[model samples]
Target: MHRSVTAGAAAAALLALSACSSSGSSGSSGSSSPAASASASSAVTGTVTVFAAASLKNTFTQIGKMFEDAHPGTKVVFNFGGSDTLAASIVNGAPADVFASASLATMRTVTDKGDAAGTPTVFVGNGLEIAVQPGNPLHITELQGLANPSVKVVLCAKTVPCGAAAQTALAAGNVTVTPVSYEQDVTATLTEVGLGEADAGLVYQTDVKGAAGKVDGVNFPEAACAINKYPIVTLAHPSR
Candidate 1:
């Protein structure tokens, strides 16, 4: 799914201010305090739209609420989905102010298109883990356990960050496990395990954390090799 920022007018205002500031005298007080205050107040009364990877849904939503509270009348809206899909949308002219991708590859899509405001920053790191129903019902232990034909496994599609990490981990362990489904995102893969639709699934540690009591997480040594870094960027022409 793709979500676009709806603050088109707000963004235009901000951009106008930025352009004016760049051309006006740096020592001018008119462009200093007023512009800064306007920029700050923009967040206080309007909306800021963010597009993030599915794995960041819980954490980012919590942070967004805190941000809104700090700014009183401001609202923070988010669109969460696969990093690849989100990048594609942004490059295609989606109105997004901020973007947080699960992997650098996806973030590059926006940067490559000259759509980013500034250099992207690494905000977080996550490692792969096996998610299963509570109580270890399947007796799944290591990555190799996924190969058990009796165990129904689900994994993210190769184009998604989590799926690529899972593939690397599997390669490190030299095990090829067949999955019943290829999810579009890590959260979807974890959801399948939580729902008991699959015996197990490979997902990010952060995803399992968000699932809370819905699933159990098992750590494997190979996951260290599959650690993923999340990157965030502010678009060059934000729609506020």
Candidate 2:
């Protein structure tokens, strides 16, 4: 998925102030001191809508909660999906303040359209892994193991970042796989294996870690060749 601050720092500050002013909340009661009231009146409050990659769901949820707590009345709403899909939505005029994509390529879609508030930045990196049923039932091992005819694999569609990374890793290992299905996103591909619908799937290492008991992660040396850099940018949209 992509990584960007919801808005530029100044814009975010302005948005927070706007939310505080609209709520018309006086932080202290009538008995409070004037200085205390002034302090309370300056509290930040507003809703920031963010478009993020599916893989960031868990981590970003935590971050959002912390931000809301720190800002008191501020709200952070997230729309998590494939970076490519989210970029398309933003370029097509979808309302989003921040975008965090899984790859620089997806981020470029928004940047190319002049939809970004500033230069995109790389915030995180992830590598691919093999997700399988909770045990070594298939005895699958590496990128080579996925090439087995009976593996019943699911891979992300080539257009998606994770799928593209998987392809790079496969090429590095000189292995081939004919997936039974091609999912539009890494989460969906992981879902197939988590639900026992497929024997194995190619997904991000973080995804396998997030799935916990639903799937087991198998790391291969070839994953080094396909590490994905996550990029984030603020969209050039009015603050909510």
Score candidate 1 by TM-score against the native. Answer: 0.82
TM-score of each: 0.82, 0.83
Instruction: Give Cα distance to truth, residue 206, candidate 1, Å.
Output: 1.3
> lDDT tens digits, residues 1-240, model 1?
112323442343233323332232111122335654565445335667788889878766776776667566556678899999999999999887778888888899999999987777664577888998998887888999999999999999999999999999999999999999999999889989998999999998877877888999899999988888776767865653
What residue runs in model 1 are displaced by over 4 Å at the alpha carbon? 1-44
lDDT tens digits, residues 1-240, model 2?
Answer: 113232233234323322332232111111234653454345455667788888777667766776677666567788898889999999998987778888889999999999988777565678888999998698988789999998899999999899899899999999989999999898899999998899999998878878878999898999989988876666786344
Off by over 4 Å in 2: 1-43
**Native-referenced Cα lDDT, model 1:** 0.76
Show the lowest summed lDDT stretch of 10 residues, model 1.
21-30
